[model samples]
Target: MLDKLAKAGDIIAADAVTRAIAKLSETPVPAGVHVEATEGGVLLSGRHLRRRMLGDPQLRNFGK
Candidate 1:
């Protein structure tokens, strides 16, 4: 029972992470900024620093 619960918890966590990543990938990047998702992970590029700072309050300095 405990093992099953543990497995279920892991699945839920993984799903949440995947959903969050998809949400982030769908966000529109600022003009000149580009975003792409590959097996390696998300790739972000461009001069528009503001858009890159989305979802991370700690990185707000980049937005400024």
Candidate 2:
């Protein structure tokens, strides 16, 4: 029983780690956002930066 419990705990921990990795691997910014490497750090800007960042629904028809 103890061994089975440990195995289940290990599986749960591994699954948590995998989910964390997947979340971290995702891009923070949405597509169409410009990324610039500046001397200070990084700067993000674009024509639709505000809309994209805010997840505007109408963005689906952008540039159409």
Candidate 3:
């Protein structure tokens, strides 16, 4: 996926996913989860991706 994205001129998404995977030493990725790069951040195509990126949505403030 990163390869395809990189070839399509998406360095930002590719880099973000690469970094995210690298930091998965202790985290466990759930099944059937797809990842893609978005303008705001890396988009995890699954529910678990939420916890993987943001610890808890309710705990964070989106309206900075």
Number of the top-ranking candidate, with TM-score as the measure:
1
**TM-score of model 2 (CA atoms):** 0.42
For residue 54, model 3's alpha carbon misses the true position, in angstroms, by: 21
Off by over 4 Å in 2: 29-64
Model 2 Cα displacement at 25 (Å)? Answer: 0.4
Model 3 lDDT, residue 38, Cα: 46
**C-alpha root-mean-square deviation, each candidate:** 5.6, 9.3, 10.6
TM-score-superior candidate, 1 or 3: 1
Q: At residue 64, what lDDT does model 1 achieve?
A: 26
Candidate 1 lDDT by residue in tens digits, 1-64:
6999999999998887677666666666556667676544566776655555765453343322
Per-residue lDDT of 1-64 in model 3, one digit per residue for the tens?
A: 5888667777776776667654442243445555454444544566665565466443233222
lDDT value for model 3: 0.51
Return the TM-score for each candidate structure. 0.62, 0.42, 0.27
Model 1 ranges off by over 4 Å: 38-41, 47-64
Q: For candidate 2, list the clashing residue pairs, or say none.
A: none
Provide backbone clash counts, one per model.
Answer: 0, 0, 0
Instruction: Indicate the residue-level lDDT of 13 in model 2.
Output: 86
